[model samples]
Target: MLNGLKVGDKAPIFEGLDQNGKKISLKDYKGKKVVLYFYPKDNTPGCTAEACNLRDNNTLLAEKGYQVVGVSIDSVESHKKFETKFELPFPLIADIDKKIVEQYGVWGEKKFMGRTFDGTHRTTFLIDEKGIIAHIIDKPKTKDHYNQIIETWEK
Candidate 1:
């Protein structure tokens, strides 16, 4: 498993610029459940689908006391365009330096279409109000990620 981090572990704190260039930190959401999701890139098919799924269910997530945060190696500019294009309602961290991904251990080797490359793995950490990881979704279904999250937490 990435980072060897497991449920109940304290999540690594992160601070970075979001799509709007606003500073966001994990500490800022203290006392709130956090849906910390890491995607490979912005605008890719799977990534877009995953983001839109979260966006569509953002209200429900908030109603359940969950705050969503996205992170990728994409730049702030790229994130801005992606956010605008998709009308995403959550913060997309412009992790251009890969610090957050590295900290989360989501950055690593990946394979696609008979090719291998180093990139960010799609992963989600369900963080509780206390900043401890309550669960981890190592392979989220992009098209139905909202349901997946809700089910995981409900269990």
Candidate 2:
């Protein structure tokens, strides 16, 4: 098992192409709080719900000084389609190479319907402005993810 990051750990920095083919680097968000979330796929039910929840709460998250960034092994084209279809306001990183996901240690074995396979885990890392991990949500509540994040930070 890869050693995943945790609270108080310095977040691993990486860059990838966003849905629009724009290069987005973790270093660019240095002075801003970042919510880096890793999911299994694009256009999936749970993933869609989580993304929509975040989209609906975008203003609130922005007002609270948190910028959201999503990462998945899905291609840029797939991400673009998902964003356009769902009106996602945040940048979704297309980690097709799996570099960023591996760096963050979110890629792992998962079991679904009694079938086991390696995949990206649904994880969220709340990073403070200094790039230190403020909190790590391993089992995020898809529908109430925004509230969970806000409450975690508030606590």
User: Pick by TM-score: which candidate is best?
Assistant: 1
Lowest lDDT block of 10, candidate 1: 1-10
Off by over 4 Å in 2: none
| lDDT (10s digit) by residue, model 2, range 12-86 | 999999999999999989999999999899999999999999999999999999999999999999999999999
lDDT tens digits by residue: candidate 1, 1-155: 57798899999999999999999999999999999999998999999999999999999999999999999999999999999999999999999888999999999999999999999999999999999999999999999999999999988
- Enumerate clash totals for all models, in the order shown: 0, 0
User: What are the models' TM-scores?
Assistant: 0.98, 0.98
